[model samples]
Every structure is written in C-alpha cells, then in structure tokens.
Target: MSKELLKGNVAIAEAALRAGLQAYFGYPITPQTELLEHLSKRMIELDRVFLQAESEVAAINMVYGAACTGVRVMSSSSSPGVSLMQEGLSYIAGSELPCVIVDIMRGGPGLGNILPSQGDYFQVTRSAGHGDYRPIVLAPASVQEAIDFTVLAFDLADKYRHLVLVVADGLIGLMMEPCELPPFQPVRTTRPDWALTGADERERNVITSIYLKGEEMEGYNIKTQERLATIRATEQRWVEHLTDDCDLLIVGYGTAGRIAYTAIDEARSKGLRVGLLRPQTLYPFPEQRVAELAEQVERLLVVEMNAGQMLEDVKLAVAGRAPVDFFGRMGGMVPMPDEIVSAIDESFAKMAQPA
Candidate 1:
C-alpha cells in the first residue's frame, strides 16, 4: 500500500473520516487547526455533518448531543480550549456516551503559549473532567501513530460506549510523515435502537447523565468502574527496549518516550546498563510493567516535558520497591537526547550513594 506524506493533524483527520465519523464539531486553535480545517472540507464533500461551533464548550456539547443518537461524533481542541470542554466531557462520560476527543496539547496554566508541551498530562490522564470516570487515553508519538490511534479510538469509543482521548503534542500535530491511511468505510446515518428518536420504537428512550437519587448514582458509578476495570486489564500497551538486561529503567510517554529510547540506546553504547519503557496508553497506564521492571532495575527515572506530571504515576507504580527519580523540562522547552543520557549517568551515581 502506498503511504501519503502528510502532516500529523491532517493525517489524523483523514483517518477519522475513514473510520466512519458521522459528525464532527470543533473550534480551532493553533497546531490542531489543520485537523479541523481538513475535516471541514472532507466532511462537507462526504455530505456528513460538520459544524464550526462558536466555542470549545459549545463544540463538546454538540458532540454530546450527536453521540446520544449513537453516531460517531468527535471534537478536537488544544489545552485551554480543552479546559472549556471539561464539563461537557464529564457530562458525556457520566451519560455513558461514546465520542472521540482529540487534544493537540499546548503550553498551559493560563493560555501560556501555542508552543508544544506535555503540560496537559495531569489534566488529561488524572482529571480529564470532574468526577471519577476514566476516559481511554492514547498517547501517540509519531504522525503515523497519530493516524493509527485516531482510527482505533473510534472503535474503542463504540465498543466501550465511553469517551476516548487521542492525545498529541504540538510537535506531532505539525510534523509531516508518510502514513498508510486506513481503508474508508461506508457510514450509517441511522440511529441505534436504544437512541432517542421520538417514540419510533414503541417506547420513549431517555438518555441522561443526571441521577437524582444517591443510590442510583452510586450504582451508575459502580457500573462505570466495572467497565473501566476491564479496559485497564486489556488495554495497557508499551514498548520495552534493552530492559531485560539493564539495571536502570527510564520510563516516558509520547515525545519524551521516543527521546528516552534513543538516549538509552546511546547509554548502552557507552557501557551504561540503562533501558527504556515507552507507554502508549496514558490511562490504564502500564503499572504492571513498571512494577515488573522495578524488580529488575536498581532505580527508575521518569522523564517528561512537564514539571514531572507523569512522575507521580511512575512513583505509584514503583511503590517504593526501587527508588524513583524525575527529570522534566517544563513550559515549552524540550529535553534533549544527550540530556537524558546524562540523567541516566547521574542516576547511577545517585544509586552509589549510601541511603
């Protein structure tokens, strides 16, 4: 199959189109504007529903409305924009609606900058929205992986009937690469039988997130947790390199992960016993893998482009069995490959210290 050289944002848009997106509602921001722009034209050409909503909040609610009809709906936004949509996302999750959300992360805390940053990791993985619901989080490091995850996101959204997040940094959104686009499938506009279609199925089916009774809400929470448990057991994915023979393990996700892989490779060349573990799923995080690697390595290093956002998770996974260290570059700065290699050298030196 021939691959198309395309920007990551555009590639993800096309992948979603092929994956049978019935509706798309979004408000544009930098880095991810290309994705919405591409979908605007493609969705129109395909005679599907595409709306440039007035604001991020309105856009996500639009997705909520479409998803209730059992259609494949999506919304994309950057960091600050995503913040505006949190309430809507929580409502969608609480209602058990299936929709795909694409977040091309930018610097944060308060419209920091348009430059790429992983500052949203905590907001995405830990507190996507208010409440205890967990959305499936997929962190794609490359343009090709972005496309693959976009396609898979739709399937997972429908299979589990819940929100699925496709997370990418501004770098991934802007970078261009050759991607083998997935095959296009015919989309169905008909609503599912369980949908609210105005009494056409001999009964009034109501869809809602509001449970008036306390006990009823608890039951809903339990059901959501049970499904989340199955997802945690089945969806953990990661890449391990030279971990089997190493004494120090470095873990990262998305861009930082790619960099760690290279740094660990170079460290091995310099006779350092360091390895790499790159997580593909941010939620349902590879905690089991982290624990297993802790048993083999002397120390664990958590690398990120934030102020150690993921570092907390790595600590929980390690659970004090092996000491864990954090290395991060906050704001818009990126950590270099040599910097990670240097961190590995320092970890060894620290381990040699008497505790």
Candidate 2:
C-alpha cells in the first residue's frame, strides 16, 4: 500500500474502519473531533453505524449498547470528554464487553486547553473508570503508530473481552505524517457466542456488570483480577532505543517519548551513555523490561507532559535499584529536545553527588 500523508486523528479513524469497525458513537471534542468527523461521512457512505450522540455521556452509553451486540464498536473524545464517559466505561468493563476507545489527550484539571498534554495518564492507565479493572492502553507516538495501534486496539479488546484504549496527546492527534493504512477487513456477520442476540440460543446468556450477591461480586472480582494478571504478563510492550551499554536511561511514552528520542540522539553525540525506554502498553506498563533496564543503568529520568503521573510507575518498577528523577510540563506545554537533554545532564549530575 502507498503511504499517504495523513493527520493522526484521520488515520486512526480510517484504520478503525478498515479493521472492521461496525459502529462508531462519539461526541465532537477538540483534537479528537476530526476522528468523529471523518467517520461521520464514511460510515454513512459505507452503510455502517455512526451517530453523534447528544453528549459524551450519551456517546459512551451508546457504545455500550452497540458493543453488547458483539460488533466492533468504538468512541473517541478528548480528556474532559472522556471523563464524562467514565461511568459508561465502567459499565461496559464490568459486563466484560469488548470495545475500543480513543483518548486524544488535552491539557486539563478542568478545561485547561485544547493543546497536547499527557495529563490523562492516571485517568486512563490507573483504571479509566472506578473499580479494580484497568483498560489495555496503547500509546501511539506517531501517525503511523496511531494507525497501527487502532487496529491492534480492536483485536486486543475482542481477544480479552475488555475495553482497550488508544491514547495520544493532542500533538500526535493533530500532527500529520506519512502512513500506510491497513487493507479493509469485512465486518463480521455472525455474533460471538457470548453476545446478547435476543436470547434465542439454546441457553440464555446473561450479560451484566452487576453481581448482586456479595459472594458473587467477590468471585467476579477474582476472575477479573486473574484476567488482568494474564494481560499484564503477556501484553507488556515497549520500544528500547540505544539501550545496550548505557549508564543513563530515560522513561517516557506517547509524545513525551517521541521527543525523548531526539534528546537521546543528541545526548549520545555529546558522549553521554543515555538511552530511552518508550512504553507502548501503559496498563501492562512494560514493568519487566523497566526492571531489567534498572539493573543495568546507574539512574533513570522520567519525562512527562503532566505532573509526573507515570513517574510513580517507573519508580515502582525500579524499586530503588536506581535513582529515579523526573521532569515535566503541565497544562499543555511540550518539552523540547534541548530541554530533555538538559534534564538528562541534570540526572547525571545528581548521580555524581554523594548519597
């Protein structure tokens, strides 16, 4: 397939469609609005399901309804808009419904800005909604990644019968890059065995998140935890850059990680043994890889576009094996390459100091 210059959000939208997405329900929100906009027309032209719901709340609930029918369904929104979908998300998750959600993160605490920010790190990774389950999160660093991860997100969601989130900062959402979209997959005609298709089967299938009895709820929780453990063990993914024989390591993801690549290259030219570990799966978190790298590096620096949210996870993974330092920008500020390089130097200097 020929690579086309595509914007991130549009690429994701098209990729989702080609991945056999049967339905799309979303509200318009900046940075991510283009995704819904693109789908709005394409879905109609293709005679697939597409609806602009009254609100983010309505959109996610609509996704919940569509997913119960065992179709490849999804929704997209920015940070605050995603917040509105949390309850519905929890409902979908509890019911063990497979669905995909895309979060094009924007600056926030409350309506912070429409610019890129990884502020939703905690919101998405540490259980996107209330309760113990964490969604499988894919962080895309470029437009190509955005496209690939969208397809992957659908597959993983169905494989596990759980929610999967493709998260990117506003930068990746708005940026344009050359990307080759996947070939279209035909939509599935038959519903899965577990789907609620009018209960006409030999045995009635009950799909729900509510376990009314205390013992039943506890049992369900145990089952969910076990599923999460399996996902964590098998799905941890990350990209290592110049990791071999490096004394200083950097940990970042999404846009922050993308910028760190440039900083690491510059730091390498400056004779610094700096490397980068960019996580692709945020929930699985690539903890094992980080722990292994921690044993080799003298210190680690974590960069973020938020107030060091993922820093805590990096620290936990290191477990005091190496000193972990953090640098971040909040409320829509993206760190520059030189800024990260400077932070790398500061980390080295800190390492040189007496404990």
Candidate 3:
C-alpha cells in the first residue's frame, strides 16, 4: 500500500479504481471536478471507460446504460448539477440499476453558490428524485472515510442491486489528508444470471420501474419497503465519541460531523460532559442508536451546515425522549469549533429547568 497526501476527491477516485470500478461518467462541477479529472486521467491508463458526458443528465443516463450492462460504474456532481441529474437518478432507482453516485454537495436551492453545504440531506436521504425508493446514502466525515465509503458504496450497490449515493460536502472533497491506497481489486465482469446483459441462454430481461397498473406498483412499493426495512435493521452505521458519560450529545454528519468532533473535544476539555454521535450512513440512519443515547443524555444538539435539515432526523430519532436543539450555518458557511461548543452550551442551558 502506498501512502500519500491526497485530497478527498482524488482519494475517492483512487478508491473507486481500486474497488474495480470500470466505468465513470460525469460532467465538470466545482469541488468534484477534481474527481472527474483524476478518474479521466487514471482510467485511460487502466484501459477503463471514462466519458465526459455533455450534461449531468447525460452522465447519469450514461451510468444507467453502463450499469445495465452489469459494469461497476459511477458518476458525481455538485448540488445544482446533481439536481439536473435527478430525472436520471429516478430512472436508475426505478430500474434497479446498481451504480454509485457521489454528490460533493455545495450550497443549493437553485444555483446558490459553490461552497460546501449540507442542504442536500433531505434530497439524498429522502430520495428526492420523485420515487418511493431509498438509495443507500453514505456520509463520509474525513478524507479517509471518503475513500472507504466509495468502496463500500460500490459493494452495497452491487449487493442490493440498487443505487448508492456517497453524499459528501465540498469541504470533505477539497481537504487534503494522508491516505493509504488499498491494493487494486479484480473487477467483477460476470453478470449475475438475473442481470440484464443481452440474453445468452435465457430469455431477454427487461429492467424497468414502470408498472402501468396501480396494484403492480403498490406491490413493488411493498417489496421495496421491506428491503429498506431489512437494510435499516442490519446496515445502520454510526461513530460515537465521549458518549459514555456525557450530558449533551452533538449529532452531525460529513464535514459538519468532523467539526462537531472538535467541538465535543473542546467542550470536554472545559469540563463539560459532551459527546458526539456522527451518523456514517445517513439513509439507513442510526435512529435506534440516537434514541438509545437520548435516554442517557439530557440534551441532543444537531449541528449542520444547513438550516436544520439534519435536525429533523435527530428530533425524529430522539422522539421526545430528550430535548433536541438545532444549530446551523447556512449558505455554505461552516461553523467553527467554538461556535458549535457555544451551541452545545446554550442547548444545555435551555434544557436546564427553572426552579
């Protein structure tokens, strides 16, 4: 294994190649353009397919096409570009195409800005692509996690035959850190007997999400829901820090999660019993863990880069078992450690009852 200091986007690209990803389709977008460039340069040397599609829509559809061929494929974009790709994302979900889509999220809600933002939380976790489906959403907090999650994303996508999204922020994408590159894994080109790959011995398989009859769609939805339930039960992942004897728990993900870590450490140094609960998998959210923590902590503070988007999930998890409060910095502004610590202090103060 070679050790190198790499940016998060480059780490993801390298990880994808190591994980046996054979195809990459994407359009240039800020914060994630390095990912496309890195993959474009490396894929050619590896004799892999790398297409700079004309648009985000085209890129996602290209992922759809390549994925249908049973190839390990991926695409990535920032928030606005990802928004444009939603139509194809919806199609990918409906057709059960196994591919990974990375969103190095930037400020959004319509061409907002090209800075790190967690505004896409609801979009990714809730499957905002106009469908009753859920994509396995992985939120990476550091550059190392970015690499690890990219590999995990592919495995999960292929295992479940569904779309998996690596939902990171621009900060995580742009930051540099030491990363140990994993050895290249052999590509799996053998399609399952069930995958759509131009029938050789069996009948032609048609992959689609369109069911003309309402009853058929309802049945599909039920199956999808059951699968999601199983995933939630077995796949929820999170990282806890200093939670064993804490009065306040700070919850966040991605870059915000890292920032919260610093805040939690600072609060502990100052003699405050503060902890952190960082959800690594945002979709198969660690709701049960948060609920269990709620019983131990007096207050739970949800800190995010958006205006309380993740706070909703935190509150839902706590479910009145603990007082949940939100602290956010919007429009791509990330909160410093002091700001987050102050938020935690304020939350605890509010939770302190009057005599």
Candidate 4:
C-alpha cells in the first residue's frame, strides 16, 4: 500500500473513487467544501458524474435518482445543510436505496458555526430525518478512520440495502494525516433482481417503506427492529485503551474521542487509573461493550461536543451500575486535553465524597 498525506475530506473522496462510486451529488458546505471540490475535479478527469447541486435538498434527491438507476451515489453536508436534506434522506431510507451520506459535522441548532463539533450526534444517529428507521452511523475520530469508514459505509449500505452515514466532524474532514490508498475496484452497475428498475418483461417492483394498513406497518416495524438487532449483534465496534486496570472509564467519539485519549494518557501518568472507550459505530452503538466496561470501572465520564447527548447513551449502557458523568463543549468550541483531565479529576473527587 502506498502511503500519502491527505486531508480527511480529500481522503474520503479518494476512498469513494477507489470504492468505484459512479456519481457524487452534493452542495457546498463549510468544513466539507474540500470534499466536493476534490470530487468535482477528480470525477471529471475520471469520466464520472459529479454535480454541485443548487441546495442540499436538490443534492439528496439527485442521489435518490442516481441510486434508483443502480449506480453507487453519495452526498455530504454539514449540520445545517444536513438538516435541509432530511426530507430527502427520509425518502432514501423509505425507498430502501443503497447509498452513502457523509455528515462532516459542524456546530448547530440553526446556523451555528463552521468549526468541528459532535453536536450532530443525536441528529445523525437518532433523528435527522423523520421515521422510526435507523441509518447505519459510523463515527470516525481521526482522518484515517474517516477514509476507512467512508469505504466501509458503501459496503454496509449495499450489504443491508439501506442508507449508511459516515458521521464525522470538521476536524476529521479537514485535518491532514497519512493514509494508505485502497486498491482500485470495478464499479457494479447491476443491482439485485429485487431492485426497482423500470418495468419491462418482468413484473414491476415497488420499493417503498410505506404501509397503508396498521398490521402491515407493524410487520415492517418488526422486521426493521429485527434487522437492527442483527446489526447490534454483528456490527458493534470500539477501541479500548488502558482499560484492563482502570478505575475510571472515559467514553467519547469523533474528535472529542481523540481529546479524551490525551486526557486518559495524562491521567495515567499521574497514577490515576483512567481508561478510554471510543465507539466506532454509533448506531449499533457498542452499548453492550460500554456496559461491560461499566462493570469494570468505578466511574464513567462521557465527553462530547454536545451537551449530554452521548452521555445519555452511556447512562443507558451503564444502567446505574456506575456513576455516569458528563463533560461537553458546544457551539463549535472543542474541549482541550486539560479541560478533559480537569473534568475527570472533578468527577473522581465527586465520587470520592459522600452522597
């Protein structure tokens, strides 16, 4: 494998190209603009399709159209821009199209800032569009993870015949890091026989998640939940650092995960047995793994770019077995290693005191 230094956005574009993506439809959004730019230039040279759509809404619908044609298609946007694409995302999910979406998260509630933030955690993993459907969400903490997950997103989308989202932050999208290029692969244009191509000699196939009757809808929901259970069993992934002998467990993802790593290292140097649990797949959330770690640690601290969004998941995983604490930096403000370390110290002190 050839190693090259690349920005996370460019690496993701390259990964898509190597994964044999045929089309890329997206709008310009801050912190993720480079991804579109890189793909736009490369697609033309590679004789592929790349369209800078008018808006995120148009871009997502464009993805829907291209995906319906059995071509590999992808789109990306930031938080506010992703919110605009929710309707289309819901359509893609409902239609059961195999496509990838990249959310290089930025601070948001409205037009929040352009800096990196994990505030989009709940939006991407829990709710962004409407519905009871869950998209496979992959969280990448570093630039390398961003590239790796972008390719994996395509595979998972196709394997499950569902939408897969690469939920990254601006830091992972814009930071420069060394990445190994993946081997080239041929694009597969032929979809499953079940796919909704145009009606011809065979019977027409209707691809939709809508069910008119309550019983039918209930059946669909049951199937979806079963699939989710399968995903949870087979796809949960995470990384542990110094956990074998730790008393404190830090839980984080995306850039905040990297920050928490540093904090964990610093605390270890000070003779505090602090470990880290970084979730890679946010949806099939590694809940069982977190619960296992909770059993071993005395206290669990959840660090994130949002105020207590991931913390809720940690609490659910621990189920009151351990004291769960939270540390967050919102509105595009990232917490430094010192701040994380301080939070760990404060949490430890609180645990040591009487109730």
Candidate 5:
C-alpha cells in the first residue's frame, strides 16, 4: 500500500471510491465541504454519480433512491446540516436500506460555528432521527482510521441492510495525516435480488417505509430489534493501550480519543499506571471490554469534546465495579493533554484515599 498525506475528508472520499461506492450525494458544510469537493471531480473522472444536492435533506433521499437499487451510496454533512437530514435518516432506517452517512460534528444548538466539537454524540447515537431505530456509528481517531472506517461502513451497512454513520469532529475532517487507501475492485451495477430494479428475473420488489397496519409495523419493529441485538453482540470494536495492570483508565473516542492516549503517555512517564480505552463503535459500545478492564482498574476518567455524553455509557459499563469520572470541553474547545493528565492524577488520588 502506498502512503500519502491527505486531509481526513479527502482521504475518506478516496476511500469511499476505493470501496466501490456507486453514488455520492451531499451538500457543502464546513469541515466536511472538502469531502464533497473532492468527490465532485473524482466522480466525474470515474464516470460515476455525484450530486451536490440542493440541501442535506435532498442529499439523503438521493441516497435512499440509490440504496433501493442495491448500490453503495453515501452522503455527508456537518452537525447543523446533519440535523436537517434527520427525517430522511429515519426513512432510510425504517425501510431497512443500506447506506453510509458521515457527520463531521461542529458545535450546534443551531448553526453553531465550524471549529470542532463532539457535540453531536447524542444526535448520532441516540435521537437524531424520529424512529426507534439505531445506526451503526463509527468514530475514527486518525486519518488512517477514517479511511479504514469508510470502507468498513459500506460493508456493515450492506451486512445489516441498515444505516451506518461515521462520526467525526471538525478536527478530524480538517486535519492532515498519512494514510494508505485500500485497493478496491470496482463493483458495477449488478443489483441484488432484493433490489427494486425492474424485477425482471424474479417477483416484483417494493421498497417503502410505510407500514399502515399497526401489527405489520410491530412485526417490522421486532425484526429491527433483533438486528440491533445481533449488532450489539458482534459489532463492538475498540482499542486498548497500556490497560493491563493499570490503576487509572481513560475513556474517549474520535478526536478526544487521540488526546486520551497522549495523556496516558504523559502519565506513564510520571510513573502513573494509566491506560486508554478508545472506542471505535459508539452504539454497540465496547461495554464488555470496559467491564473487564474496570475489574482491574481503580477508576475510569472519561474525556470527551462534549459535556459528558459518553461518560454516561462508561458509567453503565463500569456498573460500580470501579468509579467513573468525567472531564470534557464543549463548544469547539479541545482538552489539553496535560489537563487530562492532571485530572487522572487528581482523581486517582481522591478515589484511592481511605475515607
């Protein structure tokens, strides 16, 4: 694999192409605009489909149309733009369509500035859309992980016939790092049997999110739940750094995750037995791993680019086996490595002291 330095957004667009993406639909939003810009010219050169939709809403529905044809399709936007695509995300989830959506999060209650923040953690993992459905959410801490996850998102989307959301912050999207884009064999327009493509070789296929009858809807909901259960069981992914035989553990993901590792290293130099647990999948959540590590560590300090969003999940995973504390920076601010190192030292002392 040849290595090249690329901005995260451009690497992702190139990765999607390498992953055989058949179509791309998106509108411009800061930090994520480069993705649209890169794909616009790249898609043209390959004679593939790419559209700068009138809006994020229009873009996602365009994905919906392409996905129904069993083609790998994607759309991307920053936090505010993603907020506008919620309805379409729900529709895609309800119809059980496979597609990838990228959210380069920015601070937002409404049209917040485009610096960098993980404020959309809840928006992506909990309630961005209007249904009782869950998307496979991936958080990548580096440009290489960004490229890798883009390819994995398409596979996971198709594997479950569901939506897969790649969660990033403005920092990840805008930053540059060396990455090896995977070589992919281009997939042509050979629609799947379940796809709604004229239905000539089999019975006609209908793709819609409508289930007017309550029982029919309930049945679909039950099936969706089963799919979620299976995903929870098998799809959880994460990385552990210096976790074994440690007294303090740091938990973070995406941009915050990388910082957590830096803090761990600094703490280690001072002879603190601290480690990091960087989650790659937010929804399935590496709960079991956290629980196992919690059994060994004295405390867990959750570092996030938001006000303690994933801290709640870490608390649940620890379940009183070990104490869980939080340190976060919201609204486009990032925590300094020393700040986290200080928190680790300070929190560990208090937790370790006999009362």
Candidate 6:
C-alpha cells in the first residue's frame, strides 16, 4: 500500500470504512467533525448506512441499534459530545454489544475549549458510563496510529462482544502525516447467531441489559467481570525506549507520551539514563510492564496535558518501589520537550536528596 499524507480524522474515517464499517451514526463536533463528514458521503456511495443524528445521545443509540443487528457500527465525538452519549454507552455495555466509538478529546470539565487535552483518561479507562463495566480503551499518539487503532478497535469489540474506544487528543486529530491504510475488507453479509435478526423458524434470540431479577443480574455481572479479567490479562500493550539501562523513567500516553519521547531522546544525548513507557492500551493499561520497570528505575515521572490523571495509575503500578513525580499542563496547554527535559533534571535532583 502507498502512503498518503492524511489528516488524522480523515485517515481514521477511511480506515474504519476499509475495515468493514457497515454503519455510522454521529453528530459533528470540533476536532472530530471531519470523521463524520467523511463518512456521511462515503457510506452513501458504498451503499452502507450513515445517519447524522439530532444529538450525540441519539447517535449513540443509533449505533447501539445497528450493532444489535451484528453490523460494524461506530460514532465519533469530542469530549462534551461524548459525555452526552454516556447513558447510551452504559446500555450497550450492559447488553454486551460490540461497537466502536472514537473520542477526540478537547479541553473540558465543562465545554472547556476546542484545543487538545487528555482529561478524558479517567472517563474512558474507568468507565464511559455509569456501570460496573470497563470498556477497552486505545490511545493513539500519531496520525498513523489513529488510523491503525481505529481498525483494531472494531476487531477487539467484536472479539469480546464489548465496546471499544479509540481516543486521541485534538493534536492527533487535527495533525497531518503520511500513513498507509489497510486493504478494504468486504462487509459481512451473514448475521451472527446472537443478532436480533427477527426470529423466523427458530426460537427468538433475545438480548437485553434489563435483568430485573437479583440473581439474573448478579450472574450477568459475574460474566462481565470474567470477560474483563481475560482482556486485562491478555491485551495489555505499550512501547518502550531506552528501558534496558535507565535510572529515571517517564510514563505518558497519547500526545503527552509522543512529546515525552522527544524529551527522552534529548536527555539521552546529554548522558541521562532516562527511559520511556508509552502505553497504547489505556484500559488494560500495561500495568504489569510498569511494575517490572518500576523495580529497575530509581524514579518515575508522569507527563500529561491534564492535571496528572494518568499519574495515579503509574503510582499504583510502581507501588512505592520507586519515587513518582508528575508534570502537567491542564486546560489544553501542551508541554514542550524542553519542559519535560527540565522536569527530568528536577526529578534527578530530588532523587539525589535524602528521604
């Protein structure tokens, strides 16, 4: 395949289509609007389903309905827009439906701004809705990754019969880079046995989240937890740089991690033994790898565009085996490589001090 210079949002949209996306339902929001705009025309041209719903809430429900019919369905939105879909998200998860959701994060506790931010870490990794369920979350740092992960999100969702979220900040969404998209996959024509394809000759296959009885609900909850445990054990993923021999470790993800990679390279040039662990799977979180690295490093530093949201996870992984420090810029402020390099120096200084 030839590499084309593509904006992250458009790349993801095209990649999803090629990956056999049969239906798309979403409303436009900044940073991620291009994804929906691209799908609106392409889906129609391909004789697939595409509907611009009245709101995010409606869009998510549309996705839910399509997914129940066993088609590759998705929706894209920014932070606030994603919040509006939370209730719908919970319903889909509770029913064990497979679907993909793309969240291009913008500044926000409340309609913060249109700039990039990583404040959605907890919202995504913890739970996208009010439920005892944790959706699989993938954080991509580059335009290429945005395209790649979008494809992977659909596969993982179907494999586990669960929701999958591909999240990136506005930086990745708006940036342009060269990327090679996957070959087109023909959409499936046969519905899964579990799908609600209207009972014809056999007993009806009923699927619902409403297990009214206490024992029924508890039984379903146990099955959900078991599935999550399997996913956590098998799906933890991350990339490491200079980890073999380093006294200081830097942990970040998505945009923050991408920038930190540059800082760590510069620090290495200056004779600093600093490594990096950029997590790709945020929900599974690569905790085991972090725990092993914590034993090798003297200290750890977490960098982020938000106020250390991922920092707490690093601390848990470290488990006090090493000191942990955090440097962050909230409200859509991006940290430069030099700023992180300086942060590394400060961490070293702190390490040199007595406890």
| Candidate 5 global TM-score | 0.98
User: How does residue 58 of candidate 2 score in lDDT?
Assistant: 95
Q: In each prediction, how many residue pairs overlap at the backbone (N, C-alpha, C within less than 3 A)?
A: 0, 0, 0, 0, 0, 0
Quote the lDDT for 287 in model 6. Answer: 93
Q: Which residue pairs collide, candidate 1?
A: none
Summarize candidate 3's per-residue lDDT along 71-144 as a digit string, tens digits.
Answer: 89999999999899888998988887788999999987898998999999999888849989989999999888
Candidate 5: which stretches are off by over 4 Å?
A: none
For 1-355, candidate 5 gives per-residue lDDT tens digits of 7889999999999999989988999999998999999999998899899999899889988988988999999999999999899999999999899999999999867887887899888889884599788899999999999999999999999999989999998889989998898997577557777888885677898888999999999999999999999999999999999987788888999999999888888999998998899999998889999999999988888999988899888998999998888899888888999899888988778776896
Segments of candidate 6 deviating more than 4 angstroms? none
Mind giving the per-residue lDDT tens digits that candidate 4 earns over 177-245? 887878888877677777667788799877776789999888877877787788888998899889999
Cα RMSDs, all models = 1.2, 0.8, 1.1, 1.3, 1.1, 0.8
Give the C-alpha miss distance for residue 246 in model 6, angstroms.
Answer: 1.0
Report model 2's TM-score to 2 decimal places.
0.99
Question: Whole-model lDDT for model 1 versus the true structure?
Answer: 0.90
Deviation from truth (RMSD, Å), model 5? 1.1
Please identify model 2 stretches exceeding 4 Å from their true place: none
- TM-score, structure 3 vs. true: 0.98
Q: Tell me each candidate's TM-score.
A: 0.97, 0.99, 0.98, 0.97, 0.98, 0.99
Q: Per-residue lDDT tens digits of candidate 2, residues 239-258? A: 99999989999999999999
| Model 6: per-residue Cα lDDT over 1-355, one tens digit each | 8889998999999999999999999999998998999999899999999999999999999998998999999999999999999999999999899999999999989989999999989999898999798999999999999988999999999999999999998899889999999999999889888999989877998879899899999999999999999999999989998899999999999999999999999999999999999999999989999999999999999998988888988998899999999999989899999999999999989988998
**What are the lDDT figures for the candidates, one per model?**
0.90, 0.94, 0.90, 0.88, 0.91, 0.94
lDDT of 4 at 189: 60
Error of 4 at 162 (Å): 1.2
TM-score of 1: 0.97
